[model samples]
Target: MSEPLLLEARGVGKSFPGVRALQDMHIELRRGEVLALVGENGAGKSTLMKLLSGIYTPDEGEFFLDGEPLRATGPRHALELGISIIHQEFNLMPDLTVAQNIFIGREPRTGRVFLGERALEAKAAELIDRLHLPLDPKERVGELTVAKQQMVEIAKALSYEPRVLIMDEPTAALNDAEVRVLHDLIRRFRTPDTGVIYISHRMDELKAITDRITVIRDGRYVDTLDTEGTTMPEVISRMVGREIAAGLGPEGVREDREVVLSVRGLTTKDLLRDVSFELREGEILGFAGLMGAGRTEVARALVGADPVESGTVELRGQPVRITTPAEAAKHRIGYLSEDRKHLGLLLEQDVNANIGLSSIRERFQQWGFVRDRAMRARSREIVDTLRIRTPSVDQTAKFLSGGNQQKVVIGKWLVKDCDILIFDEPTRGIDVGAKEEIYRLLNELAAQGKSIIMISSELPEVLRMSHRVVVMSEGRVTGQLDAAEATQESVMHLATLRPETEAVS
Candidate 1:
């Protein structure tokens, strides 16, 4: 007989202001199998997970654990009931050690009031060791790399010994090697005692790791499929509700391009070691690297989001000091950060305000006063131009779908008329359909003579979108590849190739 369902979300429904995020969503995760929860960014996936985790109590429906109705009052209550989630955005105290972070509230005590550090580290080490994760339990989370921090999150979740473990975009920030570790752990956890709800936009992971796929669109359950019985094309089509023309073909490359953005000896905060590269007009140059390898750092430094210790940035053959994001904006350089919710958009603000923010003073200003009509008009144009699906331009960014929110960020740059665009993981939390949209936008921008520095963790994305690729390791550019010459093997080799000084990194 088949194993009993470990956890089930029964007719779940949830709503936010101006958004019906989830409705009548039903999903069953059976023991020993990994179930993929996938949909476009605003497809109610996050809302459903929140309901399952007790982060949000569903407006309707119920949850069942081992055929019993779960009465979880909050996230803590759910954790105690053996439901654990490793969030897409990490939720750890940076100042705390891995052991402390892992078993924060439930630390072992030496006496009535004192905690036993050794016992805590011992337990954390045991968990990390079991997973064969390369992480030091006693080390501070702040000192760890992004990939390592993700490992810590995994260890923390596993520490709960959860019957239902929910992983949201777990491998989003991990490299190929690091992803293998997670893959192995997933296989190891797929026993009669445990079930995993894996959420990700990456297609390959779903095919390899999941036993079944559950799709939700526009806050409603669409269908579910056995992994072995379906294909990605069909899966994507269902999630998007339309037939998508598959992948992009080789585009026309400029034979001879003029230099647009040039960085010489770009070193930053001891993370970036003598990083140097050049971008040509109408070129899509990709920055590929493992987490914390300084691809993001390089982009940040160029756009002055982070401090630059020593370097020279020349825009269109003119040396300029981009000391701040404002200065970068003045130079018409736009950076769409990988961490969009935190770094890119004002979540509480309306779409109109966000789209006009970067260009506030120049585009929608009049005599020290803002012109509301012009700003709204521009926002409406961009919303239509970018095909941003929203109720209206007045919709709060926090209420929009993840894919639409990302488009709002891009809209901000277009409003500013930015010539140099740096997109860091443009499609990180986006779905297959949205990913194609973003790719098409990038191609269109490059064709229109915009210089783009695309930073991505996905090798396939890098290969597909970029005309040239720069690979980084241990905060340094290890190698560069032409579009025709780059392969997964070649990129992975450079991406994992560490510098001698930072061998541990």
Candidate 2:
């Protein structure tokens, strides 16, 4: 008989109030194979993983592990059955040591009252050594960098001797070098005893590490293709279920209009130095760089969130002194932060509330009397235009899906009617559908004469969406590429282009 699959799900299905999150989805993973689960945002990647990891029990379907039917009531039950999931966000306790985190609930015990610290450390050390990770068992979890923290989480999962491992967006925060490291680590897990399910938006990484590519669209099984021969364009086509046309590059854009914002001889302490650029009206300008390459710093300085030691920001050829966000807003400049959860919206508030958050005072009447109806109407207008999906205008922003929440934040800025907008990692956690929607909205805004600067880590998004791309490395602009001339290789080269200290000076 042929070897049974390591794990399999049959007719897996789930439903929310207004959406079918998973519809008759089916998948299988072999003992030694890495299966890549890919789809646009809201393609049910996370929902399916939650089913596999027991975070959410499937309302319909049967799961089999090692040829035996299995059901888990919770994550702990899944762990007991040799299944583990390492989420995108690290779940380490700040106060706990690496060893303590690894052995949290299942710590070794010498007796009923005595804790076996030495044994626990030894076990943690063994897992670390096996994984070839350079983490100190005694080190506090909070002190580690994002990559290191991810390593710790992986080590903790491996501590269970898991037969199945689910990794979600494992390289989202990693730089190129760090991504290389992660790719190497993932390769080591392709052993005869372990089956891994990898979920990511990055097609290149998926192609590199995964043995098989499974495409899902609208929570339904699309197809499973051989990763070695499948093209990215084909995969994206399957995920989106539509033929997406090429985007307008800088040459394709109408640049006859005057420059809306210009930065001359821009310098900031350590983080940004001698940065200079000109943004044209009705254009989408992109900043491409690896993490810590000073893109966010540049945005922060430009918007007066960070103080600049030198450089003048000129609006339509006239110098403007922007000392604060309020001042910048007065000049019709707005910034949408990358870290949206903390900086962009009031998570607990409703959609209407978040949309009107920035200009609440203005929408109110005299003597600080709030005009609730006017604010809701304005919020509704933005929501309808931007296609923000919420149960109601009063629906809490935090409860909406990642894509919808992002739209609400975008709506806030749109309602503000800023002429020059800076979007930093705008689609970080959003699904593919929402990403397309955001891209459409951006193009519409640019077509409507809004000058935009987009900072993105994904090179494809930068290449596909921007009219012009500017690459930064080590606090300096390395090269400028018209979108037509920009490819993944050219952009990567410039993104990694590190100039000498003297050149930067």
Best by the TM-score measure: 2
CA lDDT of each candidate? 0.85, 0.83
- Candidate 2 residues 1-505, lDDT tens each? 9888999999999998767899899999999999999875567888998888889888899899998997988999999998899997778898889999988888877667546777888889988888888789999988888778888888888788789999997876566777787777777876898889998765567767898999997899999999998887677667667532334344545668889899988889756877899899899999987666789999999888989999988999999988788888778788999988899889998898899887777654457777889989998898899888887899988898888888888888887889999999989978889899999999999999999999998777888889888888767898888877776655554654444422221
TM per candidate: 0.61, 0.69
RMSD of 2: 7.1
**Candidate 1 residue-wise lDDT, 242-315, digit = tens:** 53122332443565788988889998765788888889999999888666678888888887778888989898
TM-score attained by model 1: 0.61
Clashes of 1: 0
- Model 1: lDDT equals 0.85
User: After superposing candidate 1, which stretches have Cα over 4 Å from the reference?
Assistant: 1-4, 110-115, 244-302, 307-314, 317-321, 329-505
